[model samples]
Target: MKKNLSISARLTLVMILLLAVIYPLLIAAVGKLTPGKGKGETISVNGKVVGYERIGQKFTADIYFQGRPSAVDYNAAGSAGSNKGPSNPGYLQLVQNRIDSFLAHNPGVTKEQIPSDLVTASGSGLDPHISPDAARIQIKRVASSRGISMQKVTELVQAHIVQPVFGPAYVHVLKLNVALDEIKH
Candidate 1:
């Protein structure tokens, strides 16, 4: 009976050890296999790596389209929202500040034309894509800065807009940057 109990105990210990080793390996493998914007390799242009899908960085040049506001400033490990409800006073203030900044940068734009994504933080605070409308709104500014026709800038935006892979949605920010690089060349 004692021998049988010892055997059972040994088996349990081995199983536990196996699980401990296998669990991490399984997790690592699954992480590698998972498909998402953040995990994929970033595309570069003109020997310059401008952005990453997982990190939100400022694209402030009038010649380039901008993306959404970030809460954690696009820190991947610190990804999170402001947690301020829409009605929160802090949220309102933050939005107002963004509007102010936008107006200061885009003197020719009307308040009605500014894209919502330009002032709003995405839920994850790490969103790399901006809405198509946001890209469109910046076309005039980009065109004026680059001395290109607005029509040409618009064409670039349309060409760069990533169509929905599985549904009717699109992303415009990264493509806009790539288009900007192309125009420069």
Candidate 2:
């Protein structure tokens, strides 16, 4: 019994060192190679740090493009989705309210033309990217609100499209808005 206990203790220590210490060190080393070195990647304009590229921000102004709906109210510390099922009455009403508000702000946009990402909170509620269709849908509103031409804003959105190696193209909402703000038009 003593011998078995000794071996078990030794194995436990070894496993803990290997899994907890070594594995985490390796992950940290890899993270160091990323853009932010384990910290969040920030987007800057003219040396001014605007926001992090990885976290979504709330943009209620009609002149700026909006990101996905956040159940946590753009509170990065409390990242979460609404967790309400599609069949839930409360969730349906919430989506309906978003749709109505979006329609009111965008006179020409129809309910069907609205992208799912525009009204639904993502699983993490921190997604900073939106589908191209989502950005395009708001182009008219943003252009008109900012007194910029639709063509220029559309070009900006097109320029910001990021095509992942395996997924559909998306535009980073914060980056797009920042770029839009910088444009002379």
Candidate 3:
């Protein structure tokens, strides 16, 4: 029994050193090699940082492409979803409210045409990307609002499509909106 107790103590110490200490250091080292070097990737325009590319930003204006709904209101520090299931009344009501608001701003968009991503917050609540369908659905509104042709907006959305190996293409909404601002009508 005494030998077993000693073995457990040594195991615990090893685990603490490996997981608690080494693991975090390893992660930080890896982060240092990334684009932001531990900070998130920032999108800049005119030598000024507008927003992070990996985190969502709230863009309610018709002239900008909107991202996924965020339960935490785009607060990166408190990234989280609503934690409500699909059948829950509150969740359904929330989705309906989003749909209504989206339609109100997007004049001709139908309820069916609205992508699920636009009405439902992602699990992390900080998704900067949305389905290409979601971005395309808003092109008309954005084009009209910016006084640019729909063809140009379509080209922008097509240019930003990110095709992952396992799923359909998605567009980074923040990048799209930044490009929108750069376009001269």
| Ranking, TM-score, top scorer first | 2, 3, 1
Please identify model 3 stretches exceeding 4 Å from their true place: 1-7
Q: How much lDDT does each candidate structure score? A: 0.76, 0.91, 0.88
Q: What's the CA error at residue 22 for candidate 3, in Å? A: 3.2
Off by over 4 Å in 2: none
For model 2, what is the alpha-carbon lDDT of residue 100? Answer: 98
Candidate whose lDDT is highest:
2
lDDT of 1 by residue, 32-148 (tens): 867642266555666676666555666767777888888887667677876778899978998999998888877788889877877988888888788777777777778888898
**Model 1 shows how many backbone clashes?**
0
Evaluated against the true structure, the overall lDDT of model 2 is 0.91
Error of 3 at 67 (Å): 1.0
CA shift at 174, candidate 3, in angstroms?
0.4
Which digits, one per residue and each the tens of the lDDT, describe model 2 over residues 8-49? 999999999999999999999999999899877888888988
